[model samples]
Structure formats: C-alpha cells, structure tokens
Target chain A: MLKIIKPGLLTTVQDLGRTGYRHHGVVSSGAMDRNAHRIANWLVGNNESNATLEMTLMGPIIEVQEDALVAITGADLSPTIFGKPIANNRPIFLKKGSIIHFDRMKRGCRAYLAIGGGINVPKVMNSRSTDLRAKLGGYHGRSLVAEDILYIRKYSEHTKHTISHLRNQANQIDDFYQADWSVGRVSKIDNTYPIRVMKGRQFDWFTKESQASLVNKQFRITAASNRMGYRLDGNKLSQLKSQEMISEAVRFGTVQVPSDGNPIVLMADSQTTGGYPKIAEVATVDLSRLAQKKPGDMIDFTWITHKEAEQLLIKQEREMKQLLVGVQLRSYR
Target chain B: MEYKLSPMGDQSILIELGNTIDLATHDIVQHVVTCLDSMDHAWIIEYIPAFTSITVIYDPVQVLEIEANPFKSPYHIVANIIEEQIQQIAVLETKKQRTIEIPVLYGGEYGPDISIVAEHNHLTIEEVISFHTAGEYTVYMIGFAPGFPYIGGLPKRIATPRKTTPRSVTPARSVGIAGEQTGVYSIESPGGWQVIGRTPLELFQPNDPEPTLLQTGDKIKFKSVTKEVYDHLEAKLC
Candidate 1:
C-alpha cells in the first residue's frame, strides 16, 4: 500500500481507459501518455492495462507501507526513494515505510509510477481510469489527495517470478543518477509548430487558404486548456455553413474548431461529443508524444497519408513489447 | 476530395470523411462504420461512428499476423471485406427511428428565456408554450454531453439564437433551443442553449439501470406542466 504524502497539482489514478461506452458519450479519460503508463507497468511485471498513478509535472511524495518493486517513466522527473535517488525505466525495490518523492520534471509534463502488481482499484464502465468530467471511476472517482491509500493488486505467478528476478539483481540500479534515459522519441515529427494534422472531417468546410495556413502555421497552446481539450491560438478556421451540427462522438487528439475559429485539441479528459469542425486528428502513435506537451508549447502539423500513420503505430507497438523484454533480459545478463 | 486516415490511440481509425455534416455524406460515413463493425476481423477491438467519419481501432498484433504470412491476407480475407460491405450499405435507405414523449414546464423560473423566445417569435407567451409543446421532435443523434439528445423539428418562429455568452453551468434537465435544434441537458453543465423550460425526466442517471433516457434516432414530444408540478419534480431531483 502507498499513501500520498503530498498530492501534487492534479495527480489521478488511471489505467488503459474505459471503452464500449463511447456510443453513450464517455471519453476514455486515462493517463495522458498511455505508452509511458503501460511501460511503467511492464517494468513491474504488471498487466499492460493495469491501473497506475499518473503524476503531473510535479509528482506526489508517496509513503509505501509494504515492500514492492516500482518503475517511474515519462516526463523524466527526477525522483528519489527515501532521500536516495532512483533510476528510470528499470524496476527498483522499495523498502517498507520508505518515502518516494519527485522534485519536478526537467523535460516532460506527465510521469507514470507503476507499482508491482499494479494499483488495485475498483473499475467503472470496464475501466479503472478516472474520468474527471463525469466524476466517476478510479479511487472514489477523483484526484489523489494527501493520505490517500492506494492498494496493490493480488500478485500472480508471473508477477511474483518477475519481482523475484528483478530484486535478486537489484544491484544494477544502484547509481544515484536520476532520470538518465530519454525515452525513444516519436521519430521525425514536423517541428514547424502547427501540430501535424491530416485534413479533418470538416476540412473542406473552410476556405483553401485556411487549410494551407493550418499546415504551415505554428499554434501555441492556450491557458484555457485542460483534460477536456487544448485551446490553440492560431488562425481561426471558419466554416462556410455555420450550421448547428448535431454533436457526435469525438475521439481523443481530435482538433475541434469552435465557432470562435480557434482549434482545440481534445485530450485524455475531453468531452465525448462536440459540434466543432475537426480540422485534423493526432495519429494514435504520436498522441503520446503530443500528450507530453505542456501548455504554451509550440506545435506544427505535417500531414501524412493513412497508410504511413498505421505503419508507424504498428512499429511503435512492436517496439514497446521489445522494450519490455529488452529490459528484463539485459538485467539478468 | 479530402481523405486523411489517422490513428486514434491504439484501437481506432480516424477517417476524415468530409468537413461538413450533411445527410448525403453523413449516411455514407455511418454505412462505413456499420460495415467495418460487421467484419470478422478479431484484431479490430472496436469501431465507433461519428457524424462525419468513423474511428476503426484494431490490435497491432492482428495486423502483424497478416504480414507474417501473406497467404492469410488475401483479397477474400476479412481485412479487405469491410470496404465492399460499406459500399453495399451506403445505397440503402434510412430506417424508421425511435420516438418518445417528454413533459416540460415552460416559463416561470425553469424557463428564464421563454420571454425572449416569445418576443422573437412575435407570439404570446401562452402561444409560445402551446406551439413549443405541440410539435414532435426527432432525435438526429445523441452527442455533446451524455444522453443529451439533439432533436430536430423546432418551429422557425421560435428559432432563437444562442446566448451571446454561455452560462457557466446549465442545470440538468434544462430544456434549451439552439437554432432549429431543441434538446434537454442530460447533466448539469455549461451551455449556450436558449433555455425555454425544464423537465422532470432524468435524462442521465449514472446510478440508474439505464443512465440516459433517450438515444440517437429517438423522438420526443414536450407537454406543458404547471408550476406546482415543476417544483415537485425539481425537489425530487435533488
């Protein structure tokens, strides 16, 4: 069990997310960076979909009541275990009654901490994720607070074996060098500033000049952004009809341009439906990369064909599995 | 002429079918969604539909299977079959939709904008209430917030525009009109709809057996209620 000694800005419990309820208007409000979350779980031998703690730029100071193995990933936050620094990506043993804290992310916006056996939490709508909009799911359906007791799931044979193997060779992570490894970047994304977007559902609704400007321009994330979506400050994308469109299922990473003409990129906790015209969608593989972005960061869009995006996604998935195996085998060797 | 297919997370496809939401293209998009869903591909975890396009989410491991053995991904295989299926369904006509009756109490405190609606339509407040409750509204689709049905069939006379500034929080069951669309708020949320009244109906109940009272394609009819009745239901809601 872990208790939050200090609850940072907006720490919340999240998992692989709740699905099948999209038709009913529910966003899959889970960890902002899914790859980081899942990798943290894999390092601890937890199921790929296990629920974990998603810390924002500033992380919580947690007190563990039981001996466990944990991994910290994403955002490259410098963390310490009981005043001693810890490693990232690889699993490290935590002694009972030890305190873990994160100073601040030197690079990324969110970090994931996957405790061995994953965090045992109640599931709502087939997901252990927290949907802040609906105030449902994950640890009483809210953000983590001071003195919140997070439970660990009952371990399986695989989990027990993985824990024993990693702990037996715990001497490898003895370095005090905290936050060394920069995660594998989403390869060669368009850095011109406008989030690289393929033209969206209502792309044709806008004039040709707007479409060209959207591709070439650089948009800054606005202060009026949260989990619901990111409000971007750039060229306004006007619709020709200006009709009241029936709200429909809106996916994460969708760029919604409201009547105001500014584009808002929906994130982990965005609404399920919206009336804005979608100008582009963030590729699934790159969304995690997008998720790491902080407010005020500049983004540029580079349009790619559907086939290339799919191939990139499949390649990334394959790399994730390899990352899991590579870490475990390297430690043993 | 716009065709941009992007990945949404790990399990969905975002096909930018077109920009605007019109009947001619919307139906085609829906047909593609239903077709992809009807496929036998196990790798596809889920296929969700939207107004203008569909998101087809599939497992990477499943796609890798086809590449591992080319014989598996032939022309007759399930992966390629969805495109043909969509083409067939697109030409079919739309079917009958579900319709429902909704009782509403207009004017007074529940409907703060009834006067605005009446003044804009050039009708008496009583006439506005009667006309509002008389017509049947069709549920084009359910979106925005949960169970918040977007109904069509609003009279042009009462077609009031949205507030210049949206309210920070519109209470649950607050019925509002936006352009020709009239619907009830399933949850207490921020909205810009020209609210005409409130309903006792629990459109979204998270703890109930059925959370949303209405769905896409469902129809609704509004019937005027008394001040006393509105108070009784509002009291029960809390």
Candidate 2:
C-alpha cells in the first residue's frame, strides 16, 4: 500500500487508456508521456499497460506501507528518500515506512511512477485511466488527495526476485535501494526541435498564408493548456472561406483551428468528435515530446509524410522492445 | 461505396464518405463501420463512426507482424485492407433497427430554457412540446459527451438557435434542441442548446458492462410524461 502524504499539483492513475468506448463519446484519458509510463512499468517488471501514477508539474509525497519495488520515470521532479536523492529510469526498492517526496521540477513537466505489481484500481470501461470530466476510472474517479491510500497488486515473480536481490544490498542502508545500471533518459526534453505533423483533412480549406505560417511560425503554449488540449497563441491562421462543418472523428495530436483562428492541439483527454477545422496532426513519435512541454513554452511545427511518421513510430516500438529485453537481463544480474 | 481515405495521424485513418450530412452519407458510414467491426482484425485497435466519416485507429507494430509486406508502411497496409474489405461489403440489412422511446417531462423547473425555445420559434410552450414529440428522430451519432445522442429530424416549427451564452452546468437527462438537431444530455456538461424537457431514463451508466443506452444508427422517439411518472421512474433508477 502507498499512502499519499501530499498530493502535489495533479496526480492520477493511468494505463494505456480506455479503448472501444470512443464511439460512445468517451475520451481516452491516460498518461501524457506514454513512453515514460511504459519505461516505468518495465523497470518494475510490470506490463507496459499496467496502471501507473502520473504526476503533473508537481509530484506527490508517498509513504511506503510495505517493502516494494518501484520505478520513477519521465520528468525528473527530484525524488528523494531519507534526504538521499533517488535516480530515475531504474528499479528502486523502498523499505517499509519510507517517505518518498518529490521536490522542485528539474527538467520535464510530468513523471510516471510504477510499482512492482502496478496500482490496484478498479478498471472502468476496460481501463484504469482516470477521466476527470466523465468521472469514470481511477481512485474514486478522481485525482489523489492528501491521506489517500492506494493498494498495490500482488508482485510478479520477477518483482519478488528483484526486491529480494535489492534487499541484500540495502541491509546496511536506512531507507531505499537502487540498481547500479539505468535505462538512461528516454529522450531529452528540448523544445528546440520542431514537432513533426501531417496535413489534416481540412488543410486545403485554410488560406495559403495560414498554411505556410503553420510550418514557419513558433507558437507559444498558453496558460490555459491542460490534459485536454494546448491552446496555442501564435499567428492567427485564417481560412479561404468561412464554412460550417459537421462534427467528425478527432484524435490525440489533432491540431484544430476554431473560428478565433488560434490553433488548439488536442491531447490525451480530447473529445471523440469535434466540429472545428483541423489544420494538422502531430506525428505519434513526437507526441511524447509534446507532452513533456509546459505552458508558456515555445514550439515550432514541421511537415512530415505519413510513411515517414509510421517508420518513426515503428522504429520507436522496436527500440522499446530492445529496452525491455535489456531491463530483463539487468534484473537477472 | 465511393470514399476517400486519409491519415488522421500516424496511427489512425480517416474514411470520408461524403462532405454533406444526409441519410445517404450516413448509411454508407454505418455500413462501413458495421463491416469493419465484423472483421475484428488484430491490428485494428478501435474505430469511431461519425456523421460522414469513420476514424480507424490501428497498431503499427502489430500490423507489421500480421502483414506479409515488410516493405509497405503500416498505414498503407491497413488502408489496403480497409479498401479491399469495404469494396466487398454489401449494405447490412439483416441487423434489426432499434428505436428507443425516451419519456420526457417538459416545461417546468426541469427545463428552464423551454420558454426561450418557445419564444424564439414564435410558438406556445405547449405547441413546442407537441411539435418536438410529434417528430420521429434518428440518432445520427453519439458524441460530445458519453451516451449523448445527436438525434436528427427536428420539426421546422420547433427549430431554434443555440443560446448565446452556454450554461456552465446543463443538467443531465435534459432534452435539448439546437437548430435542426435534438438531443438529450446524458451527462452534466456545459452546453448552449436550448433545453425544453428532462428525461427520467439513464442514458449513461458508467459501471454497467454496456455503458451507453444509445448507439450510432439507432432510432429515437420522445414521449411526453407527467411529473409523477418522471419522479416514479427516477426513483426506480436509484
């Protein structure tokens, strides 16, 4: 069990997300940085789909109720135990009654914390991801509050072995133990590289200037950004002609331009359908990078072919599989 | 069966049946969705059917494992499969249509905007409710919110524009009209549609195995009921 000592800015349990419910208008609410989430789960010897606690700009202070193996990945929020700094991208063995606190943002905006057996939360609509708007999944369908106690599932065989191995090393230590080797950071959180995008269905409807500016301009993520979308403040993209459109299917990373001309990049919690004119869709490979970006951050966009995007995604998936194998070998050692 | 397929993103393909929203376009959309659902390919994650298009989301890595063509991109491979499947798909006539009757309690505390709708349409509150109930509505799609049905075929006499300022909290089960479309708010949300009545029936049940009461291509009929009936049905739900 893990008790929340202080429930930071925003922390919710998430997996891959609820599938097969979008037709029913259910949003796919999950971890913003899925790559990091998967890494955290893999480090703890859990399936990538296992639910992990997704902490936002701030992170929660958790009190360990039992000796458990865990992993912290994504944003380096400066996690510490017994005033000793803990490293990310590796398996960590926490002693009972240990206080794990995350202080100050060091690099990224969101971090993922995965326990050995995963967070034990009732699945709603086939997922444990917390959909705040619908009040559907996660712990009572909401973010963690102070004093909230979260139960952990029974550890896997690998997790148990890893814990015992780490325990031997931590016998002399007071609070926690970690592996000497690490997965290293997945990707550097830098806004310098342009986020790649493909032209949307309504791309032709936009004016020539607007279409050109889309790739050339640097848009600043507004303060109103959240899990739902990032409202970008940049060059007002105008259309060739004003037209009304029927609501159609939209997805995460869809860049929709409303009547106001300011583009809104849909995120993990975006609605299933939208009537706004979509200008571009960010490539799947860059979605994790975009997720790491905070409000007031500047970002640029670049065009990429669908084939190129798919190739990038396939490459990433291959690397992820290799990393899993590497982690498995390290665990045995 | 003429349609255009484009990438929604790297993982999703958008099938645009037509530009206009009409019965013909809707039929093709439904046919394509039904056909895709029947196939249940391993690579296909999920597909969402909208007014005139369907977005099919698939796994790139899974597609590579299943398909023989290693040279072809996952998007192209999935597109080929969709095109081949859709070409052979005949209109599904065997599936029986379901028309759900929603009992609504009109014009009172439950519907604060009933008077607004009536005034805008130059009709009495009673006339507005009669016209709304008189029309047989078709569920074009379920969207915007969970289980919220976008029912088409609103009577011209009762058609009204959406509120200039949307309510921060439009009560759940409120039957509303915006322009030519009518729908019931399955969940409490901010909405601009002029709500004329309230329903006792639960459209969204999050805990149930089948969460939504309505689905795409389903028919809908609104039957007016008294406050007593509303209270009794509401109590039964609890």
Candidate 3:
C-alpha cells in the first residue's frame, strides 16, 4: 500500500489500455510511452499489462506503507528515497516507511513507476487505464491527489518470489537495495530521433508539395497538445482536393490534416473516428519516441514502408520479451 | 462491391468499402464487421466501423504466435486473413437492426441553435422539428466521444452549416447537425454543430452493461416531447 504525499502535475493510474470498445467510441487511454511502462513492469516482475502510476512532467511524492519491490522507468524525474538518489530502470526494494519524492524532471515528458503487485484500481471496460475525457476508469476516474491511498493488487508468483529474494539479500547499510543489473540505455530512446511514419488512408489527397513539406519540415509540438492529440506547428499541409470526407476510424499516431493545414497526431486518448484527412501515421515503434516529446520540442518525420514499420515493432516486442525472461532469471539468482 | 485494404499502422488496417457515404457503402461496412465479430480471432483486438471504412486493430504478437516461424509481416498476414474471411461473408443476409427512439425537447434553452437551423433552411421552427422527427436516421458510426452516434438520413431541407466558432461547452445529449451529418453529444464536449434539440435519455452511461445506447448499423428516431415531459425525464436522469 502507498499514499500520495503530494500529487505533482498529472499523476494517474494506467495499464496497457482497454480494447474491444473502439467501435463504441471509447479511446484507448494508457501510458503514453508504452516502452517505458512495460520496462517498469518487467523490472518488478509484474504482468506487462499491470497498472502503473504515470507521472507526467512532474511527479508525486509517495509514502510507502508496505515493504515491496518497485521500479521507476521512463523520464528522469530525479527521484529520491529519503533524500538518497534512486536508480531508474531497475527493481528496488522500498521499506515500509520509506518516502519517495521526485524533485524535478530532468528529461522526457512522463515517468512510470510499477509496483511488484501492480495497483488496485477498478477495471472499467476490462482496463484500469484512466480516460480523463469520459471520467470512466482509474482511481475515481481522475488523477491522484494528496492523501489518496493506493492499494496493491494480489501478488503474483513472480512478484512474491522477487520480494523474498530482495529481502533475503538486504544489507545493514541501507534498507533499500537495487538489482545488480538494469534495463540498459540501449533500450532507452532519445526524443530527437526522427519519428518514422507511413502513408495514411488519405495520403494521396494531399498535394505533392504538401507531402514533401511534411517529410522535410521540422514541427514544433504545440502547447495545446494532450493525451487526445498533439497539435503540430509546422508547414501547413494543403490538400489537392477540397472535398468533404466522411468520418472514418482513426487510431493513436494518426496524423490528421484539418482545414487549418497544421497536422494533429492523435494519441492514446484521441477520438475513435475522425473526419479530417489523415496525411500520415506515425510508425508503431516510433510512437513511444513521439509520446515522450514535450511541448515546444521539435520533431521531424521520416517516411517508412508499411512492411518496415511492422518489422520494427516485432523486433522491439522480441527484445522486451527477452528482457522479461532475463529479469525473471535475475530474481531467481 | 470493390473495397481497398490499406495498412493504417503496424497494428491496424483500414478497409475502405466505397468512395461515397451512402446506405450501400455502410451496408458493406456492416457486413464486414458482423462477419469478423463471429470469427472471434484472439489476435483481433478491436473493430471501428465508420461510414465507408472499418479499422481492424490486431495484436501483432498474437498474430505471430498463431502463425509459425518465418512469416511475412504480421500486418500483411493479418490483413490477408481478414480479407479472405470477410470476402466469404460479404454477401450475407441482413441481420435484425436495432432501432432506438430518443425523446427530445426542441427549441428554448436546451436547443439554442434551433432558430439558426430554421433560418438557414428558410423554414419555420415547427417545420424544422417536424422534418427532423419524421425521418429515420441510420447510425453510421459511434465516435467523437464515447457512445456519440453519427446518424445519417437528415432531410436536405433542414441541413445547416456548423457554427463558425464552436461553443466552448455543449451540454451532453444535445442533438445537433453540421452539413449533412447529425449526431448527439453523448458527453459534454466543445462542438461546432448547430444544436436543434436535446435528448432526455442518456445516450452514454458508463455504468450500464452496454454503455452506448446505439451501435453501428442501428437506427434512430427522434420523438418530440413537451417541456413538461422533458423536465420529468431530466429530473429522473439525475
């Protein structure tokens, strides 16, 4: 169990997200940087879909009420346990009375903390992810506030084993101890990397010049961006045809070009259907990189083939699976 | 009966049924979605049906597991499988479509744009309400917000352009129209649609087993109610 000491910025409970409800217009609201979220869970030996705390920009100061194993992944929030700096991307044991505080965000936009047993949140539509727009899921369908209590889910075999292993190796110098190894920096992506995109449903609707500009120009993330979509301030993409389009299904990373010409990339909390022309779609693997980008951050898009995007996603998933196995083996050791 | 299947991303594909947004095009979209729902493929995560297209989201990892080693991209593989399966049931018998009647109060504070719609169409407020209630609208899709149905079949006479600057906060259950499309705001959201009426029944209730009252391929009819009846239903909603 844990209690929120000071809820910073926008801290909410999120999982892999709800599925089988897009047809009903429910958005798949989840951790923006899924790569980071998964790593946090893997480090703590939790299921990949286990609910974790997604701290955006700033982070909350939490009081640990139970001795448990946890991992902090994504954004460098300068986290400290009782004034001692804690390592990210590795499993660490937290004493019952330990207090966790995040001073400032050094890098990235959002951070994730995964408890070994996950978080106890009501699963609306088969997910614990918070959809702020609809106020449907998560803790009371909103962000965490001061003094809010959070309970852990029933411990899994992996979690119980990991906790016992860490406690057995406890040291006299410190009550908390981090795992020997961690998710390496090789897996940690940089926001500066060119986001790869594929041609969308209405890619041909845009003029050739507009298409060229889309790939060549650097777009600054607008301040109006949120989980729903990222509004880009870049070269205005004009379409060759002015015909009104029928509303169609849109998903996360869909780059919609409205009448204003500036592109808007739909994110995790975006509406399911869109009427605007979709000029391009961010590649699945590159979505994590895009997700970490903050307002005013510059981003460049590079076109990739549909086949290439699929291969890249498969490769990332394979690496994550391998990492999970390695973490499980470490817990046993 | 021509359709195009295009990859939206690594995990999803957009199957375009036709060029237009008419009943015939929606029929194809409905047929494909109904067919896939019966398949119950574990790899298929969700399906979003629209006016003339359907987006099929699949778990690439699950697809890879289903297909043994050395397969082409999962996106291509899943698309091929879906294409093949949907083709078989493209000409299926029409299923019993669900029809929902939404009780609405036309004009006054609940429908501020009612006068605007009447003026734009060069018709009396009474005529606008009569025409809107007379036609049966087909639920083309549910989107924009949770359970917000995009209904078609609005009479051409009463069609009006959206407000230039959208209202900051349109109350939930506001029945509005923009151009040829008509929809209800299932939740309170900023919108540009010209609202002509407001429904008493909740179109979207998260607590309900089926949150959305309407679904894709359903039918909708607006039944006008007196202000007294509207007040009674509104009071009951709370």
- Name the runs in model 1 displaced over 4 angstroms: A165-196, A202-217, A234-249, A258-262, A327-333, B1-40, B47-80, B87-97, B207-210, B226-238
Give the candidate order by descending lDDT. 2, 3, 1
Residue B55 in candidate 3 has what lDDT?
Answer: 86
lDDT tens digits, residue span B148-228, model 3: 888889999999999999999999999999998788999999989999889988888877789888998998889999999
Q: How far is candidate 2 from the true structure (C-alpha RMSD, Å)?
A: 1.2
Which ranking of candidates, highest TM-score first? 2, 3, 1
How do the residues B1-238 of candidate 2 rate in per-residue lDDT, one tens digit apiece?
6899988888998898988878778878888877887786898988888889999989988999988697788888999999998888865542356888999999898888899888888899999989988998778888899998888889899888999999999999999999988999999999999988899998999889999999888878889999999999999998
Per TM-score, the best of the predicted structures is 2
lDDT of 2 by residue, A204-301 (tens): 99999999999998999999999999999978999999999888988899999999999999999999999999999999999999999899888899
TM-score of chain B of 2: 0.96
Candidate 2 segments exceeding 4 Å error: A185-187, A190-192, B91-94
State the weakest 10-residue window (summed lDDT) of model 3 chain A: A184-193
The digit string of per-residue lDDT tens for model 1 on B1-238 reads 2345554433455665676655555555544654565667666666555656666656655766753554532212334444455546635544444567777988778889989888888898998888888876766556666677767677777888899999999988899988777889888899899888988888876555466788654567898888787778768877
Candidate 1 global TM-score: 0.83
Tell me how far the alpha carbon of residue A45 in candidate 1 is from the true structure, in angstroms, after superposition: 1.1
Query: How many clashes in each structure?
Result: 18, 0, 0
lDDT for each residue of candidate 1 in A1-333, tens digit (9 for 90 to 100): 999999987789999887666656666788888988988887777787999888887888999888787888777678887577776776677657778888787777788898878898877777899888778888888999998999999875555765566556555544222222323443222233434455566777887777777777888888787777888886777776776664555677788788888888899887776767777777777777788788888777788655556566767878877777765564344
Give the Cα error of residue A108 in candidate 2, in Å.
0.9
Error of 1 at A68 (Å): 2.2
lDDT measured at residue B201 in model 1 versus the true structure, 0 to 100: 83
Candidates 2 and 3 compared by lDDT, better number:
2
